[model samples]
Target: MFTIPSPTIVNTSSRPLSETTIVRRKTRPVRVGHVTIGGGHPVVVQSMINEDTLDVEGSVAAIIRLHKIGCEIVRVTVPSLAHAKALSEIKQKLVETYLAVPLAADVHHNGMKIALEVAKYVEKVRINPGLYVFEKPKPNRTEYTHAEFDDIGEKIRETLEPLVVSLRDQGKAMRIGVNHGSLAERMLFTYGDTPEGMVESALEFIRICESLDFRNLVISLKASRVPVMLTAYRLMVQRMNELGMDYPLHLGVTEAGDGEYGRIKSTAGIGTLLADGIGDTIRVSLTEAPEKEIPVCYSILQALGLRKTMVEYVACPSCGRTLFNLEEVLHKVREATKHLTGLDIAVMGCIVNGPGEMADADYGYVGKQPGYISLYRGKEEIKKVPESQGVEELINLIKADDRWVDP
Candidate 1:
């Protein structure tokens, strides 16, 4: 057997662990729902349920499931007056049920009534800036001039301003959610399609909001393309520093695909920003159901050392000396431990190589015979367990010992 360094990281024992090597971007704290953003909190995970706005029970159940899967915040689309009403019921249910996380209401209107109605219930009101009801605009005026375009934007801001004030006054949080696809056409026409243009447009509105004396805000500059999304956020972060504004950032790669491509796009865009300490909260916006996002979000945070709870698994790819069906066995072990948060388990093959791979593991299965397996933890053989009971035995061992618990 061959020897190699283990990929599984050691637990925090305060035993001379390596210091965080990267420099983090410092930003002020913002409260979104019950979770705190910025000011050194663990990076939060969020998911949006694309369900009926008035379906209060459906939305509440969806959010409860999201919470169980470690989603810190849940954003629901409030497309109309009815959906806004649902938010009121949803928020009341959340309070009565004793689920403490905050709700976010997403509104794409150019008006404030919806924002105001949901503001009382939601922790954050996500406003996708637009001229009030621009999607369903009035008939074209007799010879629309350039001022018409500019007027539409200003008018939209005007509609949003009072609502923004109401939200601030009523203690509702807000996120300036900008989409690369729907960048105000006039701004796109003026600056052309570029990262600087997108960020400039976002900051332009941000400044407009700031001029109103509102500071409790977060910002999102999302692009479907990973590089464009990365570029936009980096530029926005740089400008936020230049202006000394301290709003927590919300990060995502918008419309990131399903399964592998979506995962790759999100990882590339979100991962790049996170590695530089630029993002405060993250979302894996896949084309699939919201539940698919939870594990991916946690994995990204784990890779960046931004999250604490996890089961770090280390196993060797089958390479001949790997006795037994290590592949299938490792899969079983990993599958079993998905629900076991905050424990580190290692399933490896070969007595000679497996111990080194599991040197940092809390409980390990090194190699197996036809019926039994060799077990070790911290360089000592503990006991042998049947192959059938291996995964459960490992789990029971972890829960019994406090070694894997966060220090």
Candidate 2:
């Protein structure tokens, strides 16, 4: 039987009250192919391809494209038995052409057979609990009796047991993904269209999986509205704490539209939970190309100091006291040093804020005088150079310290 570990407690009375790091919630590690989620792993980034799984070559190409660009896991929708069968080809072609990218199959709307089929090919299987044993709504029915609820619950267990057993035996993972919009009819009637319903919906599925001794599970409670998404995940965590369940959570905001607002909405929901140390894996569902979502995922993780994938640039918003064209110089500095991962570079417009503001940066390019720029290694001003040669001087400084790599 699986047991949840006790949550870690730290004493900070002797130290500062504030912490600069995010303390992630304790969760058991659930491996999905070569990658592991939770158990103090770096938060994993994932995105789904929109291609039809029936087109095996197209799907293989799409998965490779996403995996090459740092999407740790790629999900493909398996709507029908045929699509589920096509994953066999997709997995084989990936191994033959590129590499064995960790793949997940999104199975929904009475997807027992589909899930079982695709589970043979993919590392993980994601199911919408509300749709897994889909209960179509009765427009006239207002409420469900306790017996009726338990009766349908039994049916869900019967249908889910095979998949759980299959995954448990195969050493694969399952995601109990609950969407606020798609709560089962019984859940909607029992708890209404709220976060409570979403949590309960996931809990029902979770209990069934646990009953079968299948514990390699990840959970997600996602909603398009930030408040609903946030509240549902929080409630789920509370319940899990009480129940001694330590399943890792997969965080996302489903159908977060496209473009700027989509990114903001995704960040608002995913970022908030991550700040509170809530998620183990994340997906930013944008209506744009799947490739566009990877950068946003890394940016969120980078901004939170959870992961460092690119140079961290610290630039001040220019003011009248500025000594150079701040925006232009910042751009030039970025272009020259963007490839330097794991380094913090600061661009400050004036000496007033330059040294102090960029004290923690690995390197700094600051406005020293009208026609010159100050170069810094940490807080010390190394030299002043002509504005035209500032970027070159920064590169020279980095090379001097043996940190420059050819890009």
Candidate 3:
């Protein structure tokens, strides 16, 4: 319900129904298995399997379930040497079953061994720049001098060099995923624990990879705070542009808790960036089951008109003028025609709010009286029917017009 003005947006739609159209940022493509991200490819939807990585069967099943529901990329945590070794089995099982989904190893805290061991088995490996090779910051910390800072950077490079070389040799990719909650001590000292610090943490690792002449890299700047999340990603894009580094970006709001708040926060943060054309891949980090995250991802993409995966419903908030059971009727309509995608259906409460109100809707259903319903096709009044028969009439209308498809 809150609205703010943005002047940089260009008129994207010929009709201008929404605010400015989002022009996607152009970046070099990074291959993660069979999926192509960036370089004008469609934004990829990804999710992390919550099962333990060592539990090969559980993890493999999770990935299969995710793939069935449209997840394009998947990540599994590799916290131990065993977990790192398990990635080979997981990838082997996926291959054996003819599932081509890419596996990414998420490694943190002195992950050199795991990273090196897992790199060749999976399509990509994700290292948290904050914890990949740095000591965790404490409440009481010693400030390092300039010389010490350089020494630390060199130490990090030494730690990561082997893994980077392995990834390069294997033709695999790396995601320099930096979370706002876990900023490195060096960054905290130099830039403070802020969005700037988050960007710097990622850049440090990215610079290391580039120094090695490794270009198969992706980047992410994630935070639970919407403003911080958005700010960090935007800064990353600007900095990448300035440095002429076009590595693909992965967007998310970390620790976005379960249910409606989680969905809203994820959407606000991810959607804003997607609207600005910044993200190359996205993962909605809900505390709920990971499979539940897929539909929400597709819904956000569909709402922005960036992708179409299902039917779009545009119903009004019913007022006292509402003549019938608006929610009941709308639900029935959705249930009946959920398979007809890329079409906008509006279920309005009254005529005064129908035709013009749902102007963007491809089809409209409006209450004409206490027991009567009116229908329209893109603002043209199509017919009226009894309220009791309204749901069936709407389906019949859609079928009559060749819009119905069996699910």
Candidate 4:
């Protein structure tokens, strides 16, 4: 049988066997307007507005709405030159009417001219490497020769140079955003429809930007499938490490459909990398309103202990030993203290395991008897109150500690 070690016999000078903290990867900071990504900054939350860029009023209002509710960076699609020009008006209006929110422009399909124009207005320009210098795929071609591959590569460089130079001179950032569904034909021919293709496509663009001495860059390799998305980002990080590159990564699972499954799918992929210390900025791409994506992003960050924007509640599942209605009482307790940010409050159904299980909480509401509930402050039993008065007493306890804030 395994034996437990005695505390008196344990070495006092030795470090703890393990730590719960996550050690983040080292990466240089890339600024998106006033917000920073990587370089030990807290993970950033982002969402894209679905409004058309040409509708400047609607787009500006949407950007302001998203920004007011914790979206640090807002993205809009620019499909043509007119839409790109519309951003200039949208930006000016935001400054005049609301705040100068950080903006990113999404450009695709041979968008060199459009990107250059939009780059003048936005803080960052995001380009899909596969579509930026689009080439209609030759249906009969099976493979690419070295000469043909290099020839198209040179074309990409020429087309991308002007926009790179514009963003560089303007002191702005660019995202080498690659999607699995739209990888370049040459990359598809060489690397097949694999994660390798996604990484190579992003790298080709990163190299072009680097060759121009422009490094204000962020990289993303997003795939709709969770496994493919996970693999692509891991491979990208591995390749970047091998090449001594420290560009920040933007993480997401593309086309994660609406409702519970979408949130779960995104969290499964994005949260896995974050736990491994990989991602810098994240967007939960849900099919719901852009506002819904913000909460999901913050929830993921809060659950991981990386950011705390709301109260953390700890409740025990009701059992036969439970002294009260756990579900109902938990709801009441939460409603009362929901606005107490940065505080951990526990709601235990019984005293048998309550004090021990909720030992780490800042404040605890635990059942002590059939008609009474005990209030605790970090494992110390402060008082026992009638069940009807438990939540109010807990609030009183917080007020006594001077931690209660009026909601």
lDDT of each: 0.76, 0.91, 0.86, 0.91
Give per-residue CA lDDT, model 3, range 1-407, as digits (tens). 12222213232212334656667888899988889889989999999899998898998999999999899999899999999999889889988985868888899999898888888798999999888886755666567678878988899999999998988888889999999899877777777667878888888889999989898999999998999888788778777777988888899999999999999999999998888777889999999899999999999998888888888898988889988788888889888888777888999998878888799888888998888999888889888988888888888888898988888
lDDT of 2 by residue, 1-407 (tens): 12223333333112234977888899999999999999999999999999999999899989989998899999999999999999999999999989999999999999999999999999999999889997877878867888999999999999999999999999999999999888888887777787878888888889988888999999999999998888888888888887999899999999999999999999999998898888999999999999999999999999999999999999999999899998998899889988888999999999999999999999999997899999999988899999999999999999999999999
Which stretch of 10 consecutive residues in model 2 shows the poorest summed lDDT? 6-15
Worst-scoring 10-residue span by lDDT in model 3: 1-10
250-352 per-residue lDDT for model 4 (tens digits): 9999999999999999999999888777789999999999999999998899988889999889999899999999999999999999988899999998888
Q: What's model 3's overall lDDT?
A: 0.86
**Least accurate stretch of 10 residues (summed lDDT) in model 4?**
6-15
Model 1's C-alpha root-mean-square deviation from the true structure amounts to 8.8
| True-structure lDDT of candidate 1 | 0.76
Ranking by TM-score: 2, 4, 3, 1
Give TM per candidate.
0.83, 0.96, 0.91, 0.95
* Residue 319, candidate 2: alpha-carbon lDDT: 97
Model 1, 53-113: lDDT tens digits are 6887888888888988899989899878888988878878877885856788888855478
Model 3: runs farther than 4 Å from truth? Answer: 1-19, 136-141
How high a TM-score does candidate 2 get? Answer: 0.96
Better of 3 and 4 by TM-score: 4
**Clashes in candidate 4: how many?**
0
